[model samples]
Target: MATGKTDLGNAFEDFKLGQRLAHATPRTVTAGDVALYNALYGPRFSLFSSDEFARGCGLETAPVDPLIAFHLVFGKTVPDISLNAVANLGYAEGRFLAPLHPGDTLSAASEVIGLKENSNGRTGVVYVRTTGVNQRGVAVLSYVRWVMVRKRDPAAAVGEQSVPTLAPAVPAADLAPPPGLDFRKYDFALAGAPHAYEDYAVGEKIDHVDGMVVEEAEAQMATRLWQNTAKVHFNQFERAQDPSGRRLVYGGVVISTAKALSFNGLQNAGLVLAINGGRHVSPYFAGGTVFAWSQVLDKAELGGPGGAIGALRLRLVATVDRPCADFPDKDEAGAYAPGVILDLDYWAAVPKRG
Candidate 1:
């Protein structure tokens, strides 16, 4: 697996508890980026896709998609955090503090917080808290991600390790919207939903059964936009030399797609409470078709003078290499067979029935 490049193949070996990896790449979020994302996903939010609407809201222009901020930060960790990953376990304490305007530059860094040896002895867990900062040194986004990494040797010199327990779920009250967010005037029509706070049930689950074929151009465009400089995800030369023989799609794209697909059932769920857990079950490549389905896991009540609302915990699954009409299940070993791309769990805010 030597590529005659930097010893990135062994980058996981150098990951130490409390070490930080910072990646700064300059980028001007562009109108083209917004347009393409809207077109591909059918996100009709005028505030994000229309400059006039954004200006009316007292903004200079349409802001970059908030999820794009997550992409920018998590994508920077592939080389150092999860290069030898067996799985991505979960996320905690994710927040978007500021909006990303088009002309602003962004950078990302991660601090290793926890590490553990698997009882199986083949893999270990590495947890890191990642942060995204704008050119002005303002923290725009922050989240914790832990991945199961393969050990170089089963019996390598053992080091003192302490594992951290992740929250089973985050409370709805803990979910914070970005500063200056006033969704009271939220345009539901432009946001692609006609139902307000009156629609939806406690146990209802909607399957957003649409499929999209990821193209080489599209994947590369998104990865570069996030400033994810992963060679395997972008370099055709590297892909040709690798055993996979195909370029890998960035995991963030899959996560975003799953979030978008959750819109069918969780359309009214505007704000994300937390990313409880997630997994990229299989390697997704360009030209593969992606389909998704969502299930409601739990619900919470939130009532105040501003009427009433609820938060729905949801599990979204994305599949590739096959369709998802049957709702496939995982094996005993926790491995998703062929045709599965992702399994994600999260919570979102939905209005409750009066």
Candidate 2:
């Protein structure tokens, strides 16, 4: 009998300051794939869920969800970028350059852009620009992420590098909506929200409470849909070559699942303002039950012709190996312990109640 091994066990030490990690494997987008995601998440926009609806918008067929691009690109870097990360600081300059359509395949790569030593000397920070491309080598999605990584040795000689100045928060006006999107014809019932542009407050934290068990089929389907092409995420036959004897669920699934759960409490909020931060603290695999919790961090009012709109900064967390019984718990050292799969900070826009 063959054994399964964890690919991430010793992968962190291999990352260098200026190295680029390119993932091998690509996922083909399909109509069924789009249907499954919409059915599970309840995002009923016609462009993504209906071929007829897409034609009305001047597209030949339904397109993949925009967020799926993030999954494809981010999943590719897990082995080399975040396998041993302590925390994710934030995301900046995220842009969706092109729409992904069914039948297209996608691949991803990342380039390290910055590195810094922590004052504690036991860890350092690494920043990278992750990009996703289609089979024809057309860029689809791109973003910047920074992570806190532990040093292999606490006393390792530090590199002389200057820390980069990160934004305190991404402003609401800076959010990039999908190209050719017209909210005037948006289906409110299908969109799953009745409120718009005026019903939120700043500094309010909402706990999005829901739980789901990731199935093997679902995990493999999602990983493939993003065109992540990571061996650890697929190839159950190959996975048996490792010690665990199982394939791991892509971490981006957990992040997206948690974001979906947040909709119950933050439903009015639209357009992700910024990814203030995120962390995948633990590994998740098939049969693992994932639960989510969220808190409101800050709120802001924006001026627009439709009316006054509100934006809420939020912290969303996902847990595996166990459910979240209490929210926002931290030890003396202020680190998330095991059972926590994700800790994310973001901003969203909501309609005000006039």
Candidate 3:
């Protein structure tokens, strides 16, 4: 029994530049997966909710939420990449390349892209590009993320640093249109909002008034459902040593919650095309009510065979206990408020219904 220890995880000393890892446990997405996703996040976008609605717009059936694909792929990388992480730093160059349907099996692999040891000699940031592929080996999702990982030994040598220069945004031309997707017949009433691409101007702010308090059990269950192996989120004893002395809420939980709340105003902007960048501004724990808001940063027309498909650049913000009534963001001097827990920039597909 003393000799039977599992692979704990990779520490900073264990990572080699350009190393590759094929994650385990390919998941076959099912209607049950989609249903559980909806139950956890409460996403109300009609395209994901109604098979008939998706067919009316040209697809045969509703695809699972893109965030589901994102989280599933992200969850796969935890054991190999972030199991020993101090924190997940940021994300870049995320794009959903294809629709993920029920019964499609998803597997993931990652390549180490960058590493820089901290000056304190306690931790280092590891950057990796993760690609999610279906059963046929067709890539469905791709993205880059950096995480702060602890060093097994403080005296370990700092390896070659290869911080990657990631793209600031995904180009409009590169946005992948779902197969046979056309929004020409999109119904604003059924989607829950009448705002089309033309209705939202750049710099427009939307306060998602609703707030949901995350309970400790709810957060743990959600993380477990994703199969994330990050120890800090699961081991109460490991979290006791953390500065906060509490199990931190996963950033994805905040994102899904905020995205669900955004339905009050951005019901039509349901499809997440890409993640340009994101930051967990600060660590938040259970028992705080989360509120959210969004700002339209930019917009472009992605014309498809179905006619005009609109893509909007949105900045989503999430705060703990503080409602985003005024679209709370960075202060005039350029610092997020104490309550702000997340700052995310992404592209969403919106139907042009006029």
Candidate 4:
């Protein structure tokens, strides 16, 4: 008889509703990680790139990019939650509770919240709520994501489905700025934009006016840097069965790329308050040049009506090899235009010029 020693991660049937999972390998974020992340995505947000600029905004030092912290937490769950995933579907109710700085040790945990078998019987959707925390056990980030996973046996029975009800968006009152964060002393010139919170109005739109090509090497490296173990991102042979015969770029990469490009106009919109909802509309492969545009969905006064901080609800859209000059988006009938790859709705904290 052969002994089972090798660990093949969980399949569809392995997940049970309400089961909690403690992910391994805690990572202490460092300045080096910050530097590498900058190199990878080239985000020019002053709050993340310059400590002096961050100090100007009343933070102790430049905090790690919220998306970086998010990716780190999401990556930790891949080995256990999505090793056999067909695709990551969408995200909802994501909120950044605290800022992560260099030297902060980060870890993650998840609870299986929902499960539903697909009609094909070869796959199922798994919904998990994952939380990342610092060494002191304070929750830094929390969100819900669902993924399609392959089943080990097509005939295995999956019991009744249980999908949790999620809010369409995080309430404005729930947006939290980092402790001691006072944007009254914000520097517009140094931050790359002079626009303040009041300059933007609801329903207004802006074209980011930049394009970035997704290189295969950089995409793979960025994914590995987060310790993401998704096979579709790294294994060419496994992806050979597909028509493209190329590995798929992680959706988070597109989000960061589109965000970096947004710096052209929204430079002072540095702090990400919440990711209410997002979707990866299409698969993005290496070599596609990505472009972006944004529309102001709504706005709110954070801290108080006359406080130094405020928030903007923005709908960020990304398209491949297509300029956002025309604002390519879903039509009245509810369908995204061609080349449109990502649709992200989130809230960002910006300074008040007062």
> What are the per-model C-alpha RMSD values against the true structure?
4.4, 6.3, 1.5, 1.7
Error of 4 at 177 (Å): 0.6
Model 2 poorest ten-residue lDDT run: 6-15
Give candidate 3's TM-score: 0.97
* Native-referenced Cα lDDT, model 4: 0.89
Model 3 per-residue lDDT tens digits across residues 1-354: 563588889898788789999999899999888888888888899999999999988899998899999989999999999998877878999999999999999999999999988889999999999999999999999999999999989998877887889999988788886888899898888888888989999999999899988888888888888889898788877642346566877778888888898888999998999999999988878888999999999998998755569999999999999988875477889988789988899999998863
Candidate 4 Cα errors over 4 Å, as ranges: 1-3, 239-242, 304-306
Positional deviation of 267 in candidate 3, in angstroms? Answer: 0.4
Predictions in order: lDDT: 0.67, 0.64, 0.88, 0.89
By TM-score, is 1 or 2 better?
Answer: 1
Q: Write the per-residue lDDT of candidate 2 for residues 74-96, one digit (tens) a residue.
A: 76666667655654555666656
Residues 120-213 of candidate 1 have per-residue lDDT tens digits of 8877888888888888999887788887777788877546576766676666676644444434444566556765445655455567777777
**Pairs in steric clash, model 3:** none
Candidate 1 stretches greater than 4 Å from native: 1-10, 26-28, 39-42, 51-62, 83-90, 117-124, 148-158, 234-244, 264-273, 299-311, 321-326, 330-338, 349-354
Worst 10 residues of 3 by lDDT: 237-246
| Candidate with maximal lDDT | 4
Return the TM-score for each candidate structure. Answer: 0.78, 0.66, 0.97, 0.97
Could you give me the TM-score of model 2 versus the true structure? 0.66
lDDT of 2 at 32: 75
